[model samples]
Target chain A: AQSVTQLDSQVPVFEEAPVELRCNYSSSVSVYLFWYVQYPNQGLQLLLKYLSGSTLVKGINGFEAEFNKSQTSFHLRKPSVHISDTAEYFCAVSDYGSGNTGKLIFGQGTTLQVKP
Target chain B: DTAVSQTPKYLVTQMGNDKSIKCEQNLGHDTMYWYKQDSKKFLKIMFSYNNKELIINETVPNRFSPKSPDKAHLNLHINSLELGDSAVYFCASSQRTGNEKLFFGSGTQLSVL
Candidate 1:
């Protein structure tokens, strides 16, 4: 079974401040990590995904994440955040094994509230 | 243009009712999926179809059934809806191989009264 855990349910930060949303996963098979953002009343939009190679991956809106294998974690980070960045973020895991169709298991989601 | 679209963006029905949520994707992907986001904001895969063939069922309840008329369309039908059935149902499509990112619809917010 594949599962993802978002440690923080809600994160409040000031504008222009750095922020990190922690995520951890557990899977018997190889897994692909992804960060999806959901604006108010909207569906999830893909932020970035870590498939292979470098441990650090960059995504849209100046966001990035580093995948730590030994720690079993993929934490999302941003050097600076804007008011527009306030939204709900979800950490998801997908089975990367061959012949496996795309089935994404998502975490509970963390609400990022950026204050001016 | 909307890459993926679902009809009846909001659904409010009484308990024990039967309803259906229709989804269509124009991205020309061969695989589509249905996901349910519960009140707690946990997104779970309900079903998946590749080339209009069932690929994953995820042990969803028999009350929930999915139909894929073609690769571009996948519809979900619910029977005997209960209060616990209220959720946001998302329709997504993808290449089914080599890629993991999915194009998702706005979702149907179903509220069973």
Candidate 2:
């Protein structure tokens, strides 16, 4: 079984400041990584995913993440954040070897608070 | 045009009552799923259906049942609603299985009074 760990539960940042959300996973097989965002009382929205190709993946809203195979990490980073960027972020993983039936395993989630 | 929608955005009922939440995805995806988010904001997968066939059923209680009448719709019915069942339920859809990312509904807030 695969599991994910999000080191921090909350991250507070000022507007235009850079931020990073750490995520790590433990799985026996090859896995696909993803980042999702959720506003207050809303469902999750996919921000970015890492399937193949380059380790550095760029997502919407100027957010990006790098897949580190050696460190087993997929950390999300943004050079500058806006007030609108404040939301809950989740890191998820699915085993590629499990075929199409693979269900995503999500992290505990981190709440990003971007203030002015 | 909302890609995914769910009925009764808020549901309030007494304990022992039965309630149902309906979900529909206009994206024409073949796979759908139900996930629960507790007060602590922990997300857990409850069920998944592919082409109206049950594909994944997590360790959810038997009181909770998921029905997929068609590819674009999936509904959840909960019996004997308990305070512990009070949480936000989200519906999602994907074009394929593992490789596909999910599009989610706003969610239905269920409160057991």
Candidate 3:
């Protein structure tokens, strides 16, 4: 079975500061990785995905993640964050060859607290 | 218009009671899924349907059932609910199966007392 692990449960950073949210996954076969953001009282929105592309993937809101196959990591990074960037972030993975079910296994979320 | 929508943004019911959550998608997607988000913010897939056909059913209890009346609608019904079921339920859809980007609804927060 595939599983995802988010190293940090919470990340606190000041506005205009750089931040990184760590994520690692364990899978027997190839997988598709994704990062999603969820604001308060809202559904998750896809930040970005790595699906047979370049190692570095850029997403909305100036967020980017690098897929490190050797390390089994896909850490999200932002050069600078804003106050509105405070939200719950999730890391998810789905098997590349799971008969097209698209079932996602998510890790425990990381809360991004942006302070002024 | 909302690409994906779920009814009853919040539901409060007593244990042993039954409840239903409805979902619909206007994105014309063929695949729909139900995901449960626990109190710890862990998300797990519970069920999925494609073109009104059940394709994936996780290790969910029999008390929880899903019905898809059409390709655009999927409804989840739970009988004899328990406190453990108190969590946010999300409905999502994809243009197709296999690594497609999923669109999620706002979610239904169910609280079982």
Maximum-DockQ candidate: 3
- The segments of candidate 2 whose C-alpha lies over 4 angstroms from its true place after superposition are none
How would you encode candidate 1's per-residue C-alpha lDDT over B65-103 as one tens digit per residue?
Answer: 999999999999999999999999999998764356888
Per-residue error (Å), model 2, residue A85: 0.4
The candidates' DockQ values read: 0.69, 0.76, 0.84
lDDT of 1 at B57: 92
Candidate 3 local lDDT, A3-74, one digit each (tens): 999999999999999999999999999999999999999999999999986999999999999999999999
Using TM-score, rank the candidates from best to worst.
Answer: 3, 2, 1
Best by lDDT: 3
Query: Ten consecutive residues with minimal summed lDDT in candidate 3 chain B?
Result: B94-103
TM-score for each model: 0.97, 0.98, 0.98
Clash pairs, candidate 2, are none
Q: Give lDDT for model 3.
A: 0.95
| Predicted candidate 2 versus true structure: per-residue lDDT over A42-97, tens digit per residue | 88999999999999999999999999999999999999999999999999998878
- Greater lDDT among 2 and 3 belongs to 3
